[model samples]
Target: MPRDRPAPDLPEPLAPLIDAHTHLDACGATDAASVAAIVDRAEKVGVGRVVTVADDLAAARFAVDAANWDPRVYAATAIHPTRANVLDDATKAEIELLAGDPRTVAVGETGLDYYWPGKLEGCATVEEQVEGFRWHIDLAKRLRKPLMIHNREADHDLLAVLIDEGAPETVIFHCFSSDANMALACVEAGYVLSFSGTVSFRNARDLHEAAKLVPDDQLIVETDAPYLTPHPFRGAPNEPYCLPYTVRSLAHTRGQDPVELAEASTATARRVYRI
Candidate 1:
């Protein structure tokens, strides 16, 4: 992480949008006031609500805590696919307890991640990630909450497992990275696709096309903040407030009005997350 990079300036206010996924903990928010400050910046940029997501035991706990701390904040809890090796019995028990919290909106970021097995030390293998993803699917179904997935270079295996395990009623592919074909497949399967800043890059024509194909009901917009900051500020530090840039990019890509896209995505987020 580059400590010196500053957060991007607020985009032209696009009102009442939601950053469907973010990490306040990674963005240097530890306490109630810090979370509020970050959300304050977001509100000024016309992004009002945020869903803080967890990637591990500590983050899961903090995600629930942060959601409880601020009314505008909601939470999604799971051990990320890369860290699936840590999903032991006690871990599952605690996460299940957290998942039952009213502030917790979804049960994920826990699908498949084949991108880090050899490169990252202690990363889980594909097999372990698959088992963990199945457990998360069961948890989400039992709770009647949406399943939020984190797919990276494992789309084929990921989709296969979702099919084998029987997907939850609502599944959200957060920061959806596949091309138009996969997007079409997911749409056909009745899954929701939540786009992030990565879709805005000039070289991301595939994601651009994927963005254009999603129906309004199945589409969502997010920041995935502190990572994948939108273009014109791609390498800069990101926060929930940076969501508008990606929303505008999505609107431009889809050839729709920005405010209209914003409103539709906000409504979709409400329906999918029930937040």
Candidate 2:
């Protein structure tokens, strides 16, 4: 069955903002020209910068290359939790080298995902996932870069491991998906919570509450592009330009002016990624 996808379009231009987490490669942008075209579209709508994250070695290599190709792009590299079993020595060595690049700003999009494979859709056992998560955590610490985490149905375990292993100084829970209590816990622990388009969904009442509690400096916004497209276009193919929709929705949820929130979120992103 062919699922109908919403046509991508420009939302109203917003104050220039940053997409803290997205995947340019997954968005059908694999070459420098294609990446630039996508980025240009984003800039026209006030999305001035983007962080393209990779979930596997192949994607990580492309992410680094894309970042090098465009000044407005930066990369985050790591093996995704579900692919934990594949994180052998050779792969880690390559990722380590990539993480050292100035264009690669973070080590992540890696964490626990109990929802996958066993619960929904994913691979690797819990043990394998934990091993990969710990390795990535260490990579971020040693590289002195922010740790970008992707948690899905394993928030408790994710937080526990970060705590047990001593989280890096800068940690970002990208596309945060948990309850308000977890949000508060992350804030209290000095971790940044990045909200994605999912926050805008009417059914995500708990997510709405969580967004409201994230402090100004600790809160950031993202499109998580090519997935989690914001409401009104929930099933659409997302691009950085679609960020305004999510930002506007987040602003409404936070009860702050949209421009104000955009500026603050952009600033927070820069501070975290150091780009």
Question: In lDDT terms, how accurate is model 2?
Answer: 0.91
- Local distance difference test, candidate 1: 0.93
User: What TM-score would every model get versus the actual structure?
Assistant: 0.98, 0.97
Candidate 2 lDDT over 240-275, as tens digits, reads: 899999999999998999999999999999899997
- Candidate 2 residue 62 Cα shift, in angstroms, is 0.3
* Every model: Cα RMSD to truth: 0.9, 1.6
Question: For candidate 1, lDDT tens digit of each residue in 1-275?
Answer: 33456767778899889999999999999999999999999999888999999999899999999999999999999999999999999999999999999999999879988889999999999899998999999999999999999999988888898898899999999999899999999999999999999989999989888888999999998888799898888679999998999999889999999999999999999999897
Query: After best superposition, candidate 1 residue 183: deviation in angstroms?
Result: 0.2
Clashing pairs in 2: 117-121, 117-122
Model 1 clashes, total count: 0
Lowest summed lDDT over 10 consecutive residues: which window, candidate 2?
1-10
